[model samples]
Target chain A: MAVYTEVTDEALAEFLTHYNIGSMVAFRGIAEGVENSNYALKTTQGDFILTLYEKRVDPADLPWFLGLMEHLAAHGLSCPLPVRARDGKNLNPLAGKIAAITTFLPGVWPRRVLVEHCEPLGAALARLHLTGEGFAPKRANALGPDAWNDLLQKSAPQADSVQAGLGRELDSMLHGIVANWPRGLPSGHIHADLFPDNVFFLDGEISGLIDFYFACTDIYAYDIAICLNAWCFEKDFSFNVTKSRALLRGYMAHRALSEAETAALPVLAQGAAMRFLLTRLYDWLNTPPGAMVTPKDPLDYYRRLRFHNAAKGAAAYGL
Target chain B: MAVYTEVTDEALAEFLTHYNIGSMVAFRGIAEGVENSNYALKTTQGDFILTLYEKRVDPADLPWFLGLMEHLAAHGLSCPLPVRARDGKNLNPLAGKIAAITTFLPGVWPRRVLVEHCEPLGAALARLHLTGEGFAPKRANALGPDAWNDLLQKSAPQADSVQAGLGRELDSMLHGIVANWPRGLPSGHIHADLFPDNVFFLDGEISGLIDFYFACTDIYAYDIAICLNAWCFEKDFSFNVTKSRALLRGYMAHRALSEAETAALPVLAQGAAMRFLLTRLYDWLNTPPGAMVTPKDPLDYYRRLRFHNAAKGAAAYGL
Candidate 1:
């Protein structure tokens, strides 16, 4: 477990006091991330996740993190709601770290999500985007292209000998993206990290969704591209057209896109490919020795990038 | 300007007592990045980057980060070399944050990269991998599919109702990758984040590389996939076959891949695609309101994913 910070049971109990979640019964580490500490807590009232903001999470961001949970929960999203404190605050300092308690949702993360699931997830994502329509918080994209550049600059010294060539290629790619970036797509709140684990299911139904730390305002089609990359590929890393169709069809079921949006899918997917490819590549090149975190394969996005390069039409995605 | 933790100059000066970089001439915030507090610093000896460890970075990982810099610098990689302190330490605590000083290289990030740059970057990357041959490290793939799933679980709750389908699709897609993950590929050190920003150049030649926080041991071909995604795409996020060939050829110049490795390119690219798609999709679905980070278009990878689905031969990439 990558428990960079330790939280005590007493500290958790004190934090839970702020939330009207009744009595706390049990608390245990979630045991899944290289960043932050999460505990699965079972309270006398119900099950909840207790997150102790670890080293990687900024204390200042806690309000947005917790408030987003409360806001989403209030807006009818089936998710863990942050428990409020006596002072009406969702965040509290504990054990010399910021902490919060959230209602534990019921359901299992599908290990074998099927095509049927894609439609609902897609629709739900669209609805989520709609719900965030009027949110007035002052935050910005936390890890956008600019941040990527900075991170790259920070680790350039260790980039081996190919740093120069890689630098040039990356610069060109970035410049190209900036030059031809799609404009006038429905820009609003987007769930930047809607992968499998964050989604929970009960008997083939999506019971809830979790995690919103990377959420920011960006293109809606970008979300669809992300789904395609995550859902459409086979284990051999080959894209599966059938899966792509399924995901797109599902997304379209709830949200109708304009012709411009539809036309942008291919290029949007390419940009999405670049985003992940850059992050993965950065992590791959900068993994510290003896760290517990695993660096993802950069090749996965490479093939996806190629596919976008060869892509000639968006109709194949049922757009 | 996302300075999660601030390091005062006094603290930096005290910390510099352990290094041979002489006295600090100047240090100021660089006014960029959503993670880490980066300052462009000038020492009595030369210009450098002083980074104050932010929320996302672990203090314990400082040594590995610094050591990797030292290792790469010794191996002829043009990157920031960590300046040792008077106490001969590469790391120091300043203003409640872990900090390090590195010799900054001179170069500008290219606005647009070309195929011509791909070859050198690829070759240099190959050489970097070769340099890692004797260095012993134990970091694994941190942001792989499994980690993606975990991140998804964390963010699913904040997904809007419309995005419900995305959650389902993502779950299914992850399961697909896990069930059908490819096999038989050479594994070694990889620069996970090879985005353009990390690479620096003088004129048209590569001068330096930076950022090693995400380096890890993974498939060598995966690195190629990452570079492809980073360098081979057009402004509209379309993959360019010509660019792909240029990148592969460049990579081949420095590291001659095995037949098995070459055979794995398409699949590796697919995996890379999925990895990026998943992360981008997740980010798209989870972007919170008013965040500084820009959400990347997920559709870009979707098209890329589709293209890989049709890829039956590796000849397209000049393998």
Candidate 2:
């Protein structure tokens, strides 16, 4: 629900002149992506998305993201491929912000997660990891375990305002999760923020995975752990074991997990839960009172972390 | 930036089963109109817009609005024609709210209105007034002269908070406007909210007019007056007589104004300015802080109102 930068028609017409992707016929600011401004664009060539990287996005990292998507789509994964201009560049300036056009993936993200959606989502995550393996450029996972301490500390002062003693619980929980974060477990580029809202589904199949701003070099199992926390939980924060099993089975169908990766599932999932909890907690405490976006409840992830902290092994996830 | 209703994929799929517009392939909430939740929908058959009526829109008035669009489009006006479902009904329940599908109009609204945009805008508006000659159903202009007093009173207490002596000025102006409001000019269905944002242009031609939720039976000249205020004013509130001349001349090309309508133009424009100023004043005073849509500055219209009040008839507008 964010369109911070307003693109004037004249500015847009001039901007489109650099591209060879036909002429702009229709464009609209879409209520998608919070990190940047996104416009669903239709040209004589095809439908696409025009993303203006806002202040929130570091312009330096865009090449890595665009290149990764190009590589993934080239390797048979369904994702947005950045359209190149006549100068053979994918990234350029539009209305004082860096912007890129990517092929529009046609599908709607599920508002309500169904059991039928989990397995296909798992498969897509695995496909992304496998296809993105050889991408030359590397991006450090900015929200990795190393960053959680600072985030939690920033959110600590007013955390209990959300719920009394909640900050203390998070302070204790984050330390344990970070220390126990499994090291040396199948690392590669992973879509670190593979939430349900970022995956589009068509006819019970995963049509495309989007919002690759969070993609980074990270543990493959950690990505799976993110999926577990994101897709396998009911609204009440109850873990749906059936969904978890289906997700894992779907993942294993592509790339069978290492024995160590399998055994470390609970800790990895705990780390994943902690990662979301800290970020959501920060947003909940800091986003301006009247902002259009309703920040996710940090406490929702807190309950998921508690479940992950109690899990026995991969068996707990029905893996 | 408003998406009040979150339509689930399951619910949408079920909803589309009643329509003959092919299966849905893509849908995204677009940041377009402020009155209703709008989604840009691409189906196998063609692209369209899905509008879910929110509480801001009176459900009882939907039939008249939808019918007007259908009638106008059928009469060769470039507008969104409501798509009838298999049951021969255009409106139906979706996600617990009434929703309808309409033809997706291509073309972007001029973000910064140019002189070239005014004449076409004027001509299209007259075409709308001319073509809507025989529309059976009539809708009252809810913000017409009779309603200005209550709106002014509601906003009066807080008006000075926005500007010194503003409340007193507006209170004094409202009475003068109400008493001198014109009796009868050419009357028909008018696009009450035909601001630049509601009109789309393609290749310097008017492609379509949209957001007819505010469409109501009113004086045709009053609608033209709205355009004079909306299109001919510079961002700094200075009236561009060159643009106004082009606009009035364009209207004259389509349907020549009667001598009475021409002489009444200044007061009609004055009434139009007051209509917007009162509503904007009310919204400015009433909209809770942190709301998504910024209430437009009431003073912008106040400045326009002052100009219109002093205008020496149609000659002042270059007619």
The model with the greatest DockQ is 2
Task: Calculate model 1's interface RMSD in Å.
Answer: 23.7
Residue B168 lDDT in candidate 1: 65
Model 1, residue B270: distance off in Å is: 55
Per-residue C-alpha lDDT of model 2 across residues B1-319, encoded as one tens digit per residue = 6777889999999999999999989999998777789999999998999999998899999999999999999999999999999999999999899999999998999989999998898899999998998788899998888888888888888888999999898888878877877887779999988998899999889999999998899899999999999999998889999999999888989998999999988888988999899888887778775576657778899999999999998998997
Error of 1 at A3 (Å): 3.0
Q: How many steric overlaps are in each model, in order?
A: 148, 0
Residue ranges of candidate 1 with Cα displaced over 4 Å: A154-168, B1-319
lDDT of 1 by residue, B1-319 (tens): 2334545444565676767776755343443444566666556675577777776666666676677778888988887888887777777777777787787665544436777677767877787788766667657777865586787675456433435465666566667655655576777777777776677655456778777777777888888887777778777867788878877777788778888777767666766777777677676766553343446766677567656656675775765
Per-model i-RMS in Å?
A: 23.7, 1.9
lDDT of 2 at B247: 92
What's the C-alpha lDDT at position B33 in model 2? 76
Residue pairs in steric clash, candidate 2?
A: none
